[model samples]
Target: MKLKSFAIFGTFLCTSRVTLAKSAVLDQTSLIYEFPNNTWVENIAARNNGELLLSIVGTPQLFTIDPSAPSPRQPVLIHEFTDSLDVFGIAEYQTDRFAVLTGNFSFETGDLGLGSWAVWSVDLNGVKISIVNEEPTLSSTPKVAKIADIPPAQILDGLSLLSQKQQTLLIGDLSAGVIYRLDIESGDVATVLNETFTAAVPIPHFAPSGVGGLHVRNGELFFSNVGQQKLFKVPIDEDGTPSGPVTVVASGLSTLDGYDDFTFDCAGNIFVTTGGGNSIEMICRW
Candidate 1:
């Protein structure tokens, strides 16, 4: 019995060492572009051409900028939703076709404007418009269209393409602590996932807002719970329906403040943005 106990202790030590060694660290950093105060950049998506599409929440606007550009890179305005006050999330659904979330939200009050949440799309392959401050130079003008209004969604903070062929979008609701799947073609919305893992802890300053980062990859739906300070995944079908139980991928992340939006690289490494912590962390699978 003593020898068995020692073997267990040895295995525990080995496991702990491996876990600690596998952690990722920021070895180098570089600034690409910085927006002005109150810009409230919420979400960003990569264009097929290697440019980045930014969704600004402080203002109802979408902008695109070339990351490869030199210092002082300027983000050209793509579209400004005068009807809405803010834009939340952006995701590329097709080639140069992106889906966007917009609504009237008050930063000061931290309250969403009811009945104002809607989904919109922008096609960068549309008409050409003159460059900003550079006359005679034309850039592709985005064709903007309102897809549907989500009257039931209190705060859809994250948007992702569930399936390109099905024309379905997976929206994360921070306030509701649920995931809603929206059919882009039929304008139909349905609740797909909701459980304790997505629930937010109540705080004094603001109401409980739950899930943040959301993405679909390898037949799995991955998300981050800001209020819970954890990352979770659920096996999902092509239609965004849950096929397996929710599982915690990472937890005990109180030090990171909260996990907001994230993206998976080609190597399956998850790059998560720490919302209040003001840092980005890369989580390795191994």
Candidate 2:
């Protein structure tokens, strides 16, 4: 395991025995629902019914997975989005604020702007539902619009909401080497970290690697190290800056778009949806 420092409440402190180890051999890699080959699942948000609110490339699908039942669960297709979206980050915010980022792609110039991007929102629960796992049918066709255009630079993975610190939306731009914070109400966007996220904590050049997936718990920022396959806990200060020394929470992840979005179940088991692995992989601390 890599040696790293531990921080408390966003302040750098002493060291700990945190290992950059595999979170756990994925115990559950069950299939929720699989669409066509063009049906590449980019981001997934778990619902209360063991179902998933999923986003496919250039489209959207809502499907369910019964861990108790089987693999290749023949994802029940729900909604097919034909908006002007290219598809990327996605998240469910309470009963009202469901959000996602329409990937930054230039149909004309093909130049992915370093700042070209947009945000869309709709009522997550308010959307019509047909199956516990089937994609939610739109009650009135969910409203889609461009909020803040992201400067595209081969932007890899991202998240719509990461924390509750006054509604700050965190997004990670992989190749552009950027982390942005967006204002939920005003639709303003700003970069959060100006440093390399995937680059090892002590590495000098290349500033590590691109950011893939990030999740916020309480106030600590928990993110998967796609460049490193390690899980890290970046504690925040009173100002919410990722100031404290970072702790290697889990490690040994395959550095091949190894992860996207992850969260802890009520039982405290850390679960992550692996990218290439096509499985809902996870680790637990009991």
Candidate 3:
């Protein structure tokens, strides 16, 4: 089978096939879709039904694109955020349900303006839409709950569903340089990793913290560091504790810059989004 690469620029979705030899060659190129120019796609989550959910940083909106649809495809705006909140990371909670992390911040400067943060349960069924998960009680209009009462020093950039059955989540703190595990059922949060990186490339006067993207696959947790420009994997125990030292998966690849979030295809191919460059890249072994 041939390895295919899908990259998204400002509005154009470019598809290419890579022929790996001593050097990799782009065999073909095609345009898949063209999104709105103002849409700054921060992260993407693939659904089981082959649809894609995109988080936009430029606006407080979430879009869904069905590539399997007929030609001349268009992305549908499925969700919108109010109260100046913008989605940074998203993960599938169930079939049509999703866990969305939102905060009040500037995507350009990476500055926390109001310093508000919360996790929400978004249902894509019927008329019922989004609900704040941190509410103390379940009601028709439950009050929004903050993740924690601590100071707004860390930027929660990435989120992944730890276990659907256990209702747990894994979140990465970009500024604080740590990974936190949150229990959706009990509202308990804990730190999983807290190692500081000495060789971090400062984000050019912006937030200069390590740890960018996060994903869990095959009982292991994988993360990327924008400062270190590296990707590492660690064994995660059944109880959600990281058990072993970090193993480097890939590093020093020129295609990656400010690696933000990544997802795996059905064939196990990895697709990474670079925040600094605003591009998507596909990785596969020859």
Off by over 4 Å in 2: 1-32, 47-51, 58-85, 104-116, 131-136, 152-156, 160-165, 199-209, 253-257, 274-281
Query: Which window of 10 residues has the lowest lDDT sum in candidate 1?
Result: 1-10
Q: Which candidate is the best by TM-score?
A: 1
Local accuracy by lDDT, each model: 0.74, 0.53, 0.63
Root-mean-square deviation of Cα positions for candidate 2 versus the true structure, in angstroms: 9.2
lDDT of 1 by residue, 158-239 (tens): 9999989889999998888889899998899998888898776664345676988799988999999887778899998877
Clashing pairs in 3: none
Candidate 3 — which residues are off by over 4 angstroms? 1-30, 108-110, 126-153, 197-201, 276-286
- Which order, best to worst by TM-score? 1, 3, 2
Residue 196 in model 3: shift from native, Å? 2.6
**Ranking according to lDDT, highest score first:** 1, 3, 2
lDDT of 1 at 155: 79
Best by lDDT: 1
Give the per-residue lDDT of model 2 (tens digit) for 236-266.
6533468677777766445443554666665
Per-residue lDDT, model 1, residue 25, is 36
* Alpha carbon lDDT at 259, candidate 3: 64
